[model samples]
Target: MRSDYLGFSCLLSAVILQATAVLAADDDVLKRGAYLMNGPVACGNCHTPVGPNGPDLSKELAGGTPFDFPEFMAFSANITPDPETGIGSWSDDQIARAIREGIRPDGTVIGPPMPIEFYRHLSDDDLKAIVAYLRHLAVVKNEVPRSTFNIPLPPNYGPPIVSQGSPSPDDKIAYGGYLVAISHCLECHTPRGSDGHLDMKRAGAGGNSFPGPWGVSVSRNITPDLEDGIGSWSDDEIKAAITTGVRKDGTHLMPPMAFGYYANITGGDLDAIVAYLRTLPPQKTTN
Candidate 1:
């Protein structure tokens, strides 16, 4: 009788320890995911609905905002883990594939403004962490409109499934370059021709025009050109512009360039971004 009781107690202790370990691991993943989504990744900036001033924090990640471009109008989807309106029904693999390959569960291509091209470089662990975090979101019911393309999509419009490894955040230039790619800086900054194709030769020269209620705001040249680009700005100045929306000259940047989303970026990430920007070839542009 004594031996049986001891055995039962040991088994109970083992089970409790196992459960505790699992919970700890899950908590770690959630923390990492939260940092990525809220900070560098800035998922909330697009996914969350916007109020008159900025993002509607109450409806965070509930989605209904429309991103209008010349090619298409893409509405951000609710990602709040609601079965009826969010990704609650999606399998983990489905979400990972959509983020890394731009293919939806229904086999349709996830069109532009999604930034799947850059996200494809996310590490496996990071991808899993993001999914785990998404799975635990508070259920919010919000149905978003389907994206519509004004022009016909090309045969191979979506990005191919690639297996590029993510750069270490410690490597300033490489990490900065990675951040720039995932952030889709070129999509907004680089000028596109009449046919809506980016002119790669003049990349980062920045003359892309986005007309809105604010007025016709052109993306500034971010290249290393002394006169027309941010070449002459100090590192602190660059960081301020990115995080505060205030330029070195004390002018406020127009909308579509949301600095608020970037306010929480760590000093290391900001340093990497500045390091990468310094490496760009000098290109002059009149904006």
Candidate 2:
């Protein structure tokens, strides 16, 4: 019996080593994919809701935060890897389809809050890496409620061809940030006039109005300005906010940031976005 136990232990160790090596081989892909999920995607800021203040840290990827809209209505769902509650039962391809096509694992269409249109251009490899990383996260097993929606969250809002000034190649971090910009992060984060169109000149300068599940909130200025934009923050600070949904002063990032899907990001890639953001012209304005 002792000999048999020894054999089992040896077998387990070997399997662990092999898995570690495999993960090492795919490290770069995971890193890049992680960047795509966090910085540009900002998935966790909104999707993976936070637990009670300093209560439990185990429910990392399990999403359940309510996402409200202008009216009192809203929706939220779990994105964890739990078999019964999260995305665990679904295959990588199914998850990818949802990211790229807005189709859910059950063949139903994921509603507007998802912004599936933005991910239509992701390279297949990037998508796969995202799947791998997500599949490997700590399973929270929390049963999140179904995501409710009012079809188009924003009324009559049609984003333009290039959401951010334009798309640049190879610089995935920049591309991701651009994706965030174009994805309408600012539309809700930045304040708008009565006419309804966003005041582009003040972009990311904050003051945007929010009406959703978390409550009536205003968007913060993300520009490079020291006072308002993220200029005063360290790269790590920005990353914490983007990844864990924690804010600059140790406060949590508010609703709509969708930090859950974004938290799987590789640490390195999130840094690159900080580098890129530092280069943008700092803007100081009161939206």
Candidate 3:
């Protein structure tokens, strides 16, 4: 009887230890995730609607940004922990998959407005941290309508690539690919070719344009073009533009640049992006 009792006690103690470990891990993850989600990456830029001046802290992560441009109309969905309104019903795995792979719980692929490209670079641990933080958010009762694009070619407008998850950490190119993704460089720089695939030949040649409130704004080619891109600009110039929203010409990059919020990206991460961008072939753009 004593032997059996000892086994039972050991099992109970093991369970307690495991639970404690899980909780500790979750707490650490939540803290880090909050910083990343709210800062650098600034998921809140779109997810949390802006106020007269900036984001209304009251609506924190309760998403409802109407992103209507000449080509697309979409709204950021609520991502709080609200069981009915937010992601409260989603499993941690489901949430992690969506963040890393851009697939919804139902296996539907999300597009455009959500900026999954940048998210595809998140490490598993970072994604887990994000999931933990998401679990603890206030569940605001906002119900955003599920997005439906009315584009005549909604299906074929962008390339039909599917994000599976982050790549092997040991692979430098893969890591660079992840950084480029989370930066969403392709979303603005890579124009679609005749077959709807990103013209790899012009990967960072820029020329992508969208109608702005006052006029059309173009994303500068990120390729290493000595004449048109950071190729000629020193590292500091690129970094300044990224962190401060100022450009090489001392003019401010317009909205959708979102550096107003994305200015929080960490120095190390920004350096990594610069390093990766330098590895790309140079391509000049007039815009």
Candidate 4:
């Protein structure tokens, strides 16, 4: 009877310890998700509605931003966890697939400029973190209009992603490249050809023009060219530009860059980004 009691006590203690550890791990996951969502990921930049003054944070990720291009009129979807209107009904795997693969749970394809291509590179852990962050958002009831694309969207972005991983931060350049890819920086920076395809050969050449309420803002060359790119700018200057939207010349950059979201990037991540930028081959800005 004494031995059985001792065994039962030990089992109970072990179970409690396991549960505590699991809770702690979950807390860590939520913290990482919050950081990524509010920082480098910045889903709010697109999903959150913008008013005359700027983004309406009250609505948060409730969505309904309109992207009007010659090719399509896209309305960002409400990603809030509202069951009737948002992603409340979406399983974790469904949300992850929608983000990385651009396939909705109902078998519809999400269209540009959703940047699923870049998101496809997101690590499994990071993707899980993002989904968790999104799942916990305040449920906002918003009915977002579906997007219309004159140009045909492909059946799928590419072959279904099997598994994805991130480079260790110890590898500064590689990690920075991973950050940039997930952030989809080149999606706006790189110039598109006549076919509306990005010219990878001149990846950071940066002559894409964005027209909005703030007027037309041309993306500048981000390559290592002495005259045309950040080659002459110091590392701090580059970081400042990214975080503050202020150029090396002290001129303020225009909107759609999501400087507000970028400001949350950690110093180590910023260093890595600058390190990656330093590796790009110098290219003159495209016409």
Q: What TM-score does each of the candidates earn?
A: 0.87, 0.57, 0.78, 0.97
Model 1 residue 213 CA deviation (Å) reads 3.8
Give model 1's clash tally: 0
Query: lDDT for each of the candidates?
Result: 0.82, 0.64, 0.73, 0.91
Error of 1 at 71 (Å): 2.3
TM-score of candidate 1 relative to the true fold: 0.87
User: Which portions of model 3 miss their true places by more than 4 Å?
Assistant: 1-22, 117-121, 151-177, 195-197, 212-215
Q: Write one digit per residue (lDDT tens) for candidate 4, span 53-89.
A: 7779788899888899899999999999999889999
Give the Å shift of residue 187 in candidate 1: 2.1
* Model 2 C-alpha lDDT per residue in residues 101-188, reported as the tens digit of each score: 6677776766645555555655566667677778767877777666655444342223322222334546766765655543445556
Which prediction has the highest TM-score against the true structure? 4
Q: What C-alpha root-mean-square deviation, in Å, does candidate 1 show against the real structure?
A: 2.6
Report the Cα lDDT for residue 133, model 1.
Answer: 79
Query: What number of backbone clashes does candidate 4 have, counting pairs of residues 3 or more apart or in separate chains?
Result: 0
**Model 1 Cα lDDT, one tens digit per residue, 84-110:** 899889899888887777777887777
Model 2 TM-score relative to the real fold = 0.57
